[model samples]
Target: MRTEWSEFRESLRRWIYFRKVRFKRFLKARRAKQEDRLAKRNAPTLIPEGANIRQRADPRQSKIKRLRADFSNDLEETRFRFKQWKHFRWMRVRHFFQAVRTRLADMPSIIGFFKYLLHKRQRSIREQESLSTRKMEAKASSWSKFRSIYLPEWLRRWTIGGKPKSVLLAFLLLTSLVFVLAAYPAYGLLKALRAEQLLENSRELHQKGDLQGAFRKAHASYMLNSETLETFRWLCETAESINYHELLSWRQRLADHPDSGPQDRIKLVRTALDFHQPQVAEEAIRNLREQEVEPSEYLYLRLLTTLAHGRPAKNAAIRQCREILSLPAPPLEAYRIYWSLCLDSMDPRFGREAVNHMKQTAAASGAVGLAALRTLLQLPFEDEKKQRLYSKMLWEHPLAQRHDLLLSLRAVFFGHSLPETALRAALGKQYDRLDNTELQEVTSILNNLGFHENATDLLPTRTMASNKELWVEGLRARIGSDETKETEKVLMEQTPFTESERRFLHSLLLRKNKEFKKADEELVEALRMATASDLPILRKFVLLHEDKATLVALLHRLAKEPAMQRWAQALLILTLQRGAEDEPLEELLGAIQANDYRNNPETANRITRLKVLHGQDLVACRKIAEGLVARYPDVREYRFTLALCYQESDRPVESLRLLEGMLSANPSECPTQRLIGARALLRNGFSSEARELVVGFEKINLLAAERRILDYVLTQTKAKQKGPVLP
Candidate 1:
């Protein structure tokens, strides 16, 4: 044990010695580096041989020396001026004291002369006072004699000679004038009071959901006091609650009123813009410009006017918008205008910068920020960074509503690589706040996007669970699920299903289960309980069934519904063409033409297809196809249809020409168009070109029908390749 301990201690000592030596080496190296740095920093400055050292000194140092010398000279001059000013001040003080001494020397004589003159003036004043008293007594006596001789008794008794009755009559006349002057204000006060009362009643009615009563009261209040902006706002709000037409009328009324203030007119213009009534907005803005308005308000109206003019005045609008936004603290409307102009430009960079500016500015906490966020969602952002930044801003915005967040999430979902889990969570939170109708819409959108589980999880846990309409939608979603059989069974066993709705649900489930006869029976029962509005539901059932009799019966049944008559007739035409029932289809077309419904593009297109399919009136079908091609030159389907029409009309040259144009325009029509084009080429007696066109089409995964068509074309080309057969 002692030997082991000795060995361990020796090893420890060796390790300690090695560490010390390494530490010493490191310290020596650090010291050497410091010394080398100091030596390099203090290296001698290079100088030309025989050069003047003073002249070659640093320019900065020389400038500093010159500044110091100039400052010293300025200090000396300042001190010298101070001394000269003090001497001048002392001399002025001496002169002031000398003048005072001279005045003191002349004071006694001046006082004695003044005393002698004062005694003489007092004696003269005494003599004049006695004469003035005697003159006054003589004048008074003469006036008394004159009054006694000229005055009459009737003049002494007149109202001007102190009669209280005339005084009272004059006072009453002045009082009457005052009352007349105040009467207008008194009437205005009474009307204003009435308007206030009416507005209060309107509020009460609005709260009670009596929108019509609220509208009447609010309109009455506005008529009573048209000058009050609040009354006008209440009127517009009430009208909007009642109906769109009413709101429009109120907006026009307020805009046309001569007495409306700037606020009223501005609100009118804003509401018109919001409702996309640009004409009304323009008229309101024109009237506002004609009236007196503040500078900011005038600028705001100008921005609105420029925006209403659209792209024609975009440059001017952008300049004015930038100027307004450059103000120290511009109004929220200025930010709104900036964003509007940005959106109009459709420049994603401008949108991104404007959104960033809005986020940093005080406008981000208010309606301006909300508008910016909404606009940001509409902008086509190309960068994922900007999209994520905008998403973060929207998520953290204090004023963002559930709808706003959901829209932001949707924007991010489409524009960025945000996690689906995060999007689902945000949508789920908003789902809880949405009303029944909004929930239904959001759920449908989710289902359509294939987020079935997320949509099912987002269902409302409260009143919506008991909502019959929502329950039906949920069942439909389940029926569309992968586990349709199980979901259908669950739906069948559920309680609270209406008889008509149960029949409808059962029909859908039966159809999914391939029990068509039972499904048709259920559908008929459901149709019996259905209303005119249920035509869409019945149409879905018709589309599911392949039986010509079932489709015709459904169409005939739907024809009785006035709202569904036209739709039913269109569907009947499609059904007849599908079944190749030429006579019935022609008769239906004649009836439709008699009704002038065939003039519609949809009906005309359908009729053209029917003629093409039935091989009847190929010339007329070609004419219709030509018109379709002319009307929709860019639509490939129209062009293809025209090609088909040409092919069937025995105009294979024209058909091949159209097909060649289609292929040249887009060669990616690898299988379908090439097959058709090859057939057209073969029909046009170009067997070699046709063989080359479809040489490799079989390598593609062609459908059985496509393969058969290709095989027939190839067989014809091969048969023609051999020499003519001997008879």
Candidate 2:
């Protein structure tokens, strides 16, 4: 029943679909007929003609017969037209050939006419040339007759021999000689002047620390004036910072100069030593003694060369160094060697003597004190003797009248504390004022030592108001602060600083606000305008800024610069360091390593921090820290890091000794230093000392966080003292 119902439904559906199709077709035919009738109604002009819609055709044979007769008439007309066209074409061709034959018959006459015209023109040109030639002949004859007949024979002899006269030749030769002589000296005078100018420019460049530019100018100057010791000295100084072989070539030039004196030779030897060319220094010293250099100068050079080349100085050498130091006005280098000898021999007398001499010398730039501090830096923390000496020297730095400013800097560098008020007063003590130069001397020392806040404080009141550099430096030193008055004043012309420089300082302000895009754009402009001198200043901005976004922009700008590409790779690592995120730093380093990324102190420190933070590569971390400490002894952070590395390496004694130096250098950070120090001491089983060290902090005021560290140190020391045993 279900199948039968389905078939019935299908049959009904098919019948209904066909009926609808047929109904639609019928409506279409009716609509077409209605449209045709409407067309005839609208026209009403010959309605029957519109209704027919086509010409009528008869079915009878009469209509076919009429059509055939008309077709025959059309064919007869076409044949007649074709015959006429064929006849016309033959007549046209015959006329064209007749015209060509007529023209060919006239060709001989046309050629004769053209030849006649050409001969006529040639005859006219010849007639004109002959007339002009006769006039010239007449003029030449008349001039010759006047000279030979009217002038005296003696005068004619003189005129004939004019160019070859002996007296005239001698005078001409003398004039040529004068010009040659005068011109050579003039050329040399001008060249010498230009060379002197270039030398001055090179001197300024070297002072500005643009080694490549300095060398370029110096090389040009030397090419012009190689005979001068001054030019050679400048060239050597500039090239010493760059290529060593080039420096040696210039050093040889200096030594080979005719005017090179003993002082010049000694300067060469010193430069060679500075360039790490001991063989050059050795060769120089060997020849210097015979040049009658002062005995003391020779001895100091020998000792300096020996010490610089990793060779130990003998007792004889030490005695000779003492004699040099004892001179009325010894060389500055002797005191440095004295510090070295003092460290090697463990002699306190030598140390005290060197210290006293550095204190008394009013002209000293604090080199001896720095040298002493650096020597102590190289010793291991396990060497208690060096540790005690370093502390005593670092703390007891006597601020003599001359050494006040520089020694404070060294003190700050070693993490030694100086009273802000005292340092400010001392800076203004002389001349009852401070200039940017002196302020810079102190500020640079402090900033390079990582005592940036102290550097900011030391800027004199209202000093940045009148000083553009001091203002910009203050802005840099005051990173991450709310201070903008000086920045605004400089930009708005509310201060005496220059407009051009203050505009550059806008980048630091932007960096402080974390507007890295504007900061990077401004830095890019500065880089475009940056001379070699401006670049060192610009790189410091990248080093100071910490944002990943800021560094990313800097990396793009620097990467496009071929000279700064290596720096770009280093900055790439520095950028990853900011987020401290998902990407592994080691993998990034390995990828950058393929690009030949050179290590700088800044990038090395960043990598070391990342390694330590991730708890990876403990050995490499310590080694890098050691290098950083050695390279930047003034940076207290590197020293502290190195101390931590020592602790990690199980050298607790070394760690404590290292911490002790920082503890003395920065005693104001008492709680923090003492905490780390006590822990290291406790780690080494010096629990009693650690306890006393923590107890001593009771006299100092500490912040809450510092107090927590104090309590923690106390707890650790107590735990170590009691062990797991019951009291």
Candidate 3:
């Protein structure tokens, strides 16, 4: 049935083609005949004029005769054209059956012609294959010799018969074992290169303030190349910098590492407690128990483990300070750890007791006093005695350059003014002693605390030019505050800045100058080069230009790509949420809840946040936040959010306690914890501390609204305080 239908269709197409050809011939013949007839009709018809030479000479009779001849020629042409149209209209109908018959008669000839062509093509293909085989045999050169000697049975047929695919499978199978055995150096090099790349990404994440991601990548680098001392050291430092849980994984390994020393063991034990891993701390203590160690070191290890693990550990940590100081010679870490534990208690009794103990210790060694003072000064009280002690210690510890720097950093952290000499002196000494990450922290502290000049001076000169990360930071600062005359020139220099980012900045300038049309054009070009990092910026630009079409286009394009699908969904969700697109948003949420198989933590976080915010139910919000906190324990932001929910739910004490742990764990980071802690502190009547906390960020760049809130909080805290004014 199918074959018959196909033949019928072919017959119909042939009939149409034949009719067209016949019409062409018919038109050609008809036009030729018409031309001859028109020529005869149009030839001047000589008619005798009514009888006279006078009549022949008159112009009226001549004009009338010419008009008649012209009309006759036009009529003949019209009639001929009509006849041509009629013939064409009837051509298909009149020749249909005749065309079918002719096509049927030619079917055998058409089939025979195709068969002839097929035979010729087969002969040509055979000749080409023979010629190709001959060429392949000729071209089989040095590699064939190597193959025959090394894996003789594997590829013998390929070379022997000059036939491709003859023994490739066998070749691969035989070569696999040998290559695996021989490829270590090459594999090692590849791993080293990949580790370096991951380390660079870690640095980028560090700059972006994604501490979780940064440390994760840094650890990944170490995992890739565990033999590299630099990578291992980087993994340790990054973990320390962010107070990450990965420390738990590497703590025991580090202790067992050959390069670890006595000091490293003690520090690791203390860090374990700081990371809130009491079990690891206890294990370290036990591990040290079987080994020979100094009495003071053993005592301190026992002290840390006791302070970390029970309900009374807080009071235990405070009471142990006296015994810790009574030793013949205390470990230098003892002073700092004792006072830090005191401050972490957030109790007045512990603070005063720590101070009393500190006075006895401070007179003996300013270094020890400085260690105590460093944690003590962060107490946020305007105590006259603490000030007097700080001033006295400044003179007493004249040789303690690094400690003085620590004291200065504390002062700067509270936005206190420092003498130029003291600031530079302390920073210069710090530059010599600090690690790379610590230097970045100090620079950031100096910068955010409004000592921009000191911060600028503190940037590491050795790697500034070569480190792309540092260069980017310096470039941002320069672009933000370069000499006015050089702003355009600085913006025009495009190295290191992505094209999309550069154009985005340029578009901002255009927007500032009220060049709306030009700004939109620049943004369109920026959208063309938009990267994953630039997605949020692209969305903002699109929104600014009211370019809904551009965003929808992005959504569509990103949807088709597997790697980009996650981002596409996120962008659409954000856009829909912003626009209050409720129906589609609900649909999206339903789809995600119903069957999303990706299992991405980030996507889950966003969805949970979206749901919690939309529902606006405190109970539901707290429940979700708690779940998120438990599931994503390493994500500091989620923990902070959970703290926030606790605070909002009127569990101020719990919230403040959690904040204290986080702040003690990692003081340099944890901005979110600080904010929530400040508010909780105020509500709990620790207004002085809250004031100091909120005021600490005043000099740092903040949004206007945030600055206003900080000022308001400061005013309220100051109103509650009756202590001596700060100098």
Candidate 4:
């Protein structure tokens, strides 16, 4: 009964579904006909009406009439078309029932038909399932392939090698075979790379001018591979040369010296002096003296004299020399003492004395050297007649015959004609005829005496000559005085000196022709070049010669360079020094007083100096002093300078207060501080404080003047019973 109910429900659902589909088709057919007939009926006509203004109909009425006509035609067409479709649908329903009745009578055919339908449905389902399964299987196969391609070795081995022992062994054997096949090529490539590296090293050595090293390296590379010689060239040069390593070993042995003995130190010192390391030579002599061993007499004396003049020790060099000379030894070291006196003494008398002593020594030994005596005679004397005579003798001496003496004679006796032949004979007297410094002096003298043409002819053009300023001045004179334009032609043709020297040249040119603006610009440009080198001191010098407004702008520019900050500091100090008595300096002092960055002790001191010069009132001065002392406790001068400021302001009481504090803490520091303190206290009528400060000075040794001042202050204070004369 339940199966029969399900079958009847199925039949009812199909019947209702088919009938609803047929009804919808019928309604659509009727609506399409109505629309077509309405379109035909509303078609426009070709007939025309008479053009009478009175015959026009109302627009609303005409529209209503046309819509009614269209509605009537639609009604008629829809009714006729609906009847025709109704007849056709009735016949279709009649044929459908007749077919159903025939199917129901043949029960076996119906069952077989249903079975065939079921089989077709089952076959379709199976085909669809098979398609989906194949798609899923393909996706799984693709995933397995991707996992093998990108996964790590451990995972791949775990996944694939789990299959069988024989397969795993085969995989390992194949991997080993591949690695073995690649190893020989890798090893050969590494060997080739090493050989190329060695060849590169050899080439680098050759480029560095180490030709022998390059050759040895090349040969070593060739030993690795004979074919390397075809590419390398260093091997040829290294064939018969000594190896660098052997030479290096020999050098090392020469350098492996123990501490030098006294004689060795003396030799080293003399050698260092010859090499122009006077400071090092002096150090070496000191070391020799420390060893307490005697050097050769000549060498010892020479070291002592060079040390005295060139590189004096912390103590007085002359005193040290005199001590060395006083030693009781052979020849008595008097020759060294005499020569030192000649070099450093302000008189030629010592030079004469040196000559006398050397003569005595040489006479005692009968081998008195003309070199030492001639050196003494050549020394310039303060007395002109004596200098001329000595110069003449030096020029005439056989061994001491020097062009320097002839030039010196001419310079000393300017405007006095030397024999023209003698001057012509000394024509080629370049500076090499004299020592370095003497050459500089001669060039300067010659250029100063309007003898530049002669000086230029005498001086070398190849080497760095002395007296650059003189040369520049000579050029300017020629440009100013000479009419041939020779100097101007030379200037245009010649290369100019560096910025500083060129600046000097331009200054001379400007001074000669009175071209101030052009000269200033040239100097400014030189200054700019020097400033670019970050030399602040040079910038300051340039600013000093410039206008104040220009100087301010230059200082602003210089402030950008870190090196010029020191220059700015120095300029500030100098400006303060020059303008300390001015109102503007007081304003600057005020600004300094208000400054928070008092960490610069020099700026602080400069402020104090300006304050003292400005003569600030006692109150203003004390505040600044207290602030500075609080900020910079170690600045003892601030306190002392502050005391002077107070004393200058007629406030002896405040001055005494400042100085008393300084004297209490630093009694032994500045003797002047104590003296100022005693004087200030006694003047302010604080006799007790003055006496106390005076007693403290007795503990430390004071100069006679300081003691006298203190004594006068004490005597005056006692005599005045009430107070020192206060303002």
Candidate 5:
């Protein structure tokens, strides 16, 4: 059916071409007949005698008239043919058929092109085979010549027959087969070569600090030939190229190679970790364990990798390292690994468990294990239960001969009730057994816990030499309730109080039954000593006082005291208005102006009422505020204060402009700023924008007092709407 349709299309196309030619001939014949008819109609009678000419005409005149008549006939015929050709209805129909025929004729090429393509393919295969044979023959000849000349004596005995070229061809064919067999090997070598070249180049670039480019080249070599162990080795070496997936694949590949040495596998595992592929490193280490490699070394590498990946894997790493440490014939290195994992765990219970394990290990292993147990106990175990376990274990163990451990446990349970008796009980049995150092530790712990005389039982000679103030302070902590001490006095007569010493003394003084006068004297003495050392003791001094006079006097002294002067000056400005008697506001303001701390000058001015007061001196205060505002212009407080000062001194317009800038720059102006701004706007006769600003503030329902501002703005808005209430 397809073939018949195609033949019909070709025949239709030929018919269309034939009809087009026939139609052109018919049009030519029709136009010629029309021209003759027109010539007959337009011709003068006896035009054939026109060459004789008229009596008044010369010879050229007759020819001219004849030419004119002929030209008239030609023009008429041309017009008639042009009019007939305008529509050309038949040509349009023929063109449609021609397009159809042309489309149909092209269809065969489109439909059967695949079938015809087979013939071209056959020719290509034959051509290629012919070329391949010639190539094979040439290769054979070259190989034969190379083999004869270059092959060793034993290789020469392998007979190859026929003419040299035929023998050469056969020899070459065998040689080509050998090469084909060796293609993968050659590919492997080339890949290694490329990798080595890349590694060298990358090393140079890495030395030159082009890490990213070096990573790219090394990555390309790894991708191209990654089947062999060397490729894996290079991939491992170029750690930055080992992305998460490739690292996993290399780990799998390395695991497949059982012959891989422990050191090499370890190197690869480290490489995985360097690439941030902790999971792969973990898997490799596990594989090493399964292969009966040294568990201690690999487990440590895994533990370090897990930690480097962060705390999520810490528990698993701890478990694995513990397994290694638990081995009967464990590597000596496992002890350190176990110790490290314990340090990183941060769980108090784990520390206790570790100490418990150490206890057992020490009984079997001696002082080395006991020393490990002691180190474990030193980790910060804040929980009482954990400390109790540590103390109980130490008391039970024969190797735990150190009374210092029990005393350290007592220190851990100082104030809160954690069976200090139990620690004492344990130590009492071992009291005679302890060395002098252990006895001192026990004495100090007991003394600090306010069992001082009992501590004296442990070390009677040590009691007489202790610091009196420390002894007294410990007594206060152990005996006093806070209320009785609040009325008591504290003194620093014997030794100057450190900050912590002062805190303890302050708390001691605030306790019930403490002498108030003595405590007061102590606080003052402490502050004096603290000031000499440049302590910021004023804040503490203020916390202790209620009467404003004492605070003011202390602040005045502190402000000029040099050691605590700046902090004293700044705090005096902030807190003075709240407590201090009305000094000349100028004194406070003058101290602020002379102050060196620019970082918090705004804080100083805020407390001084600098922006609220109006005077010639207020200009200086405003200048400082403006300088601060200019520095941190985004700060609305500084800007708002400066703007308000401008308005208060009768520069209302400048104030309004400044307020507008502040509002535009920071639309979320606080309620205080909004209130100041609206007032400034009203005073500047910008009653409309002021009403808008006020209405905006009202919408937010900032404060109950803002209703008054809203009322005033509304009154002005209504008045303006009704017509201006002119002055």
Candidate 6:
């Protein structure tokens, strides 16, 4: 068994040795292939030594030699060109330097000039060094003096003694003293600066119309420096200007201050007089008079005191006013007081003279002149010529030429008999300068004056679509005119109105043309997209509905809305009354009365008419109608109601008289008034007069009920056979 095992082992060893030698030979052959590939990749091209000579023996060799010769010649030419280029560059540089040298040679030696500059630089450096040394010496001397004065030898010894606790305490105490001394002045300076900054901010805030913020800032400034008279003066002036409640307190402060100057006292007195505290103004004036006040100032205060206190010394006050005006450049306050006294005395000549003088002085008197001019414009002169003259003078004044002044003029004289061209010129010239409020006022004035086209033209280019209703009113005014069709054409072409406004305006135009159904449909669509402000237009459109039930239903829906409640309720009541729904009419009237409809004249009139229609309380109806007539006499509807009340109360003569006056004033304007007048005439046995009135109605567009009444009146007149009776 041992021998067999030995043989197997020997076989295994031989197999292992054979495998190892085969693997070794494989690796060596692989390495040799890789080396060969590397050698081939890196090797240079090789040629036989006689290959060139063989090529040279051929004709192609001569071509090769010629090519070589050409290449050599080109290289030589390139080198020669490069050398010439370098020579040319060097010569140009040399010529430039030679020109500079020639230019310098005509002036001064370059080296000597440089030497002089160097000398100047050295001298500057030396001077700077000397200055620095002198500064250092001065600092040293100052330090020495400080040490000699403040730091005694004993104190220096104590500092150097190295008693650690004592040294730290002394250092701390001295540092605290130094900090306290430095910080006290710095704190005062910072407070003063802060107060000054606040004052500046207050002025800016006041200019921006932030009166509350300005008051706070001004108050803080005064609190920080109560001794500053200017700060106190500003606080007082601002308080008075903004009508702040603290005005009295600030004025008292200024008056009480010992350092208050004559100007401060004068201001305090003027503010007192303006606030209607004559006693306070008198005392202030007395104090000022004691302090050597100006003659004009004293006399002005005296005149003001006299005027404010009911003119106790009227003649003396007038003489004082005259004295004040006699001064060169008399105070504006004097002129203002004199004008008031003249007005109170009913002296038109003197008042006119004062106004003329005020106008002449307004050019140079700043705010005072503007105030005087405003007062003059507000005067109630009966003569139109005088009014026009005053207005013209005001318009010509430089102070009155401001945009704000123009707005003030419009406010004061919008409804008065001012020249339209002059007013229009003034407004148009400064239209671009108006702010939003002023612009809105101008547009409203233009609209009220029947200048709708001008108002439309003056609308801002960038107005919001939400304000299209205002522009629509202008367009509504153009309806039925020659421009109406052209306006509609232009509106169709342009999109100035929003989709809703355009629809609403189209509905309005359609309604004017009597296309009710289409207009109603368009209006419904518009109302769906309409804002609250658009409800009035919608209400007017809804009122034009021929279908009473539909109108009532629509009005009922609108009445449910809080914003449209009042108008819709009134409209609904009228619709119900017109439909002869008396049962619901009483409940609606009670609801309206319960809801405080008396505050509105239309609703109250409706209530009165309902009462009259019911005949429940004719006396109460008459009283209410009379009250309405008295309250709004200019309102034709109220007067018509009163006429109806008079007719219903069996006073036919009174009713006829009222109706006749109405007819005379507004001939055929009010159909209801004409109808009532015919009824009154028929009842009063003036059938011929009734026939004459009813005949006028045939030429007008009358309602069915009105035409029936007219026909009945004409038949009754014919039956009576009354001929041409003048009642």
Compare the candidates by TM-score and give the number of the best one.
1
Which stretches in model 3 have alpha-carbon errors above 4 Å? 1-295, 306-323, 345-349, 376-392, 395-399, 402-445, 448-450, 456-727
| TM-score of candidate 6 versus the correct structure, residues matched by position | 0.34
Q: For candidate 3, write residues 66-109 as lDDT tens digits.
A: 65689999999999999999999799777997899999999999
Candidate 5 residue runs with Cα over 4 Å from true position: 1-480, 483-552, 578-586, 591-616, 661-675, 678-682, 685-727
lDDT measured at residue 72 in model 3 versus the true structure, 0 to 100: 100
Model 6 CA deviation exceeding 4 Å by range: 1-218, 234-244, 290-292, 306-328, 331-424, 428-435, 441-727
Q: Give all candidates' CA lDDT scores.
A: 0.67, 0.62, 0.62, 0.54, 0.57, 0.67
In the range 1-727, model 2's lDDT, one tens digit per residue, is 9999999999999999999999998997677667656654574343364466564433324433555789999999999999999999999999999999999999999999999999999999979866765665566676664565435444445556556678677767887999999999999999999999998998898889888898999899989987776777777777778865666666677787777777767877887776656667778887775558766777788877655523223344567777787667677678666656655543344555544454454233465555555444444456555455554454445633333343434433345445656555445565246567877666666555455677677676453656645655665655523465555443565654333233446676777677778877876676555544444445565655565554565565566667777757666665655343325456655444221311334445555644544456778778778876665465555556676667667787787666655443433232444565666767766666667657767666544434554676677665646432111
Clashes of each: 0, 1, 0, 0, 19, 0
Candidate 4: list runs displaced more than 4 Å.
1-259, 263-292, 295-315, 324-384, 415-419, 427-453, 456-489, 494-504, 512-518, 530-727
- Candidate achieving higher TM-score, 1 or 3: 1
- Write one digit per residue (lDDT tens) for candidate 1, span 1-727: 9999999999999999999999998997677667666754686766677987666443333333555689999999999999999999999999999999999999999999999999999999968865765665566675553564224323344434456887768767887999988998999999999999999999999999999999999989988998886788788888878765667667777666776667777877777766655557667767765456766677776677556544434556778888877766667777776766665443343555665665565245667667676666656677878767777777778887655666667665662333657755666655347788877776666554444555556565345645755665565556545556765665656445656656766776777788989988987887678666655555544543445666786687787788678768877886775564657777666555322343344455556655564455677767777875675464455556677677666787887777666553444333545666767767767676667668777666654445665897889888555322111
Query: Candidates sorted by lDDT, descending order?
Result: 1, 6, 3, 2, 5, 4
Q: What 10-residue stretch in candidate 3 is worst by lDDT?
A: 593-602
Clashing pairs in 2: 415-665
What are the models' TM-scores? 0.37, 0.34, 0.31, 0.33, 0.29, 0.34
lDDT tens per residue, model 5, 1-727: 9999999999999999999999998997677667766765676655356465444332333433566789999999999998788759778989999999999989988878977898889999979966765665565776764654345433644563444676677778998899999897888788778877876776677677776766666667667656556656655556534344466465556656856666666766776666555556656666565465555565567566655434323455578777767655666555655666566553443565665666566444555555555554555566767666655555555676545455445545555443646554656676567655555565555554445445534443334234543434333333332333322333433334466445435543443234556555655665555544433444433534454544655676677676667767666765654442234444566545532443344453463234253232566656666775665454456667777567656887777666566554444324546666766767756666556555555455432233554566667666553323322
lDDT-best of 4 and 6: 6
Clashes of 5: 19
For candidate 2, the 10 contiguous residues with the lowest summed lDDT are: 592-601
Residues 627-687 of candidate 4 have per-residue lDDT tens digits of 7566435445666766766666687777766655555453533455556776776776666
| TM-score for candidate 1 | 0.37
The candidate with the higher TM-score, 2 or 3, is 2
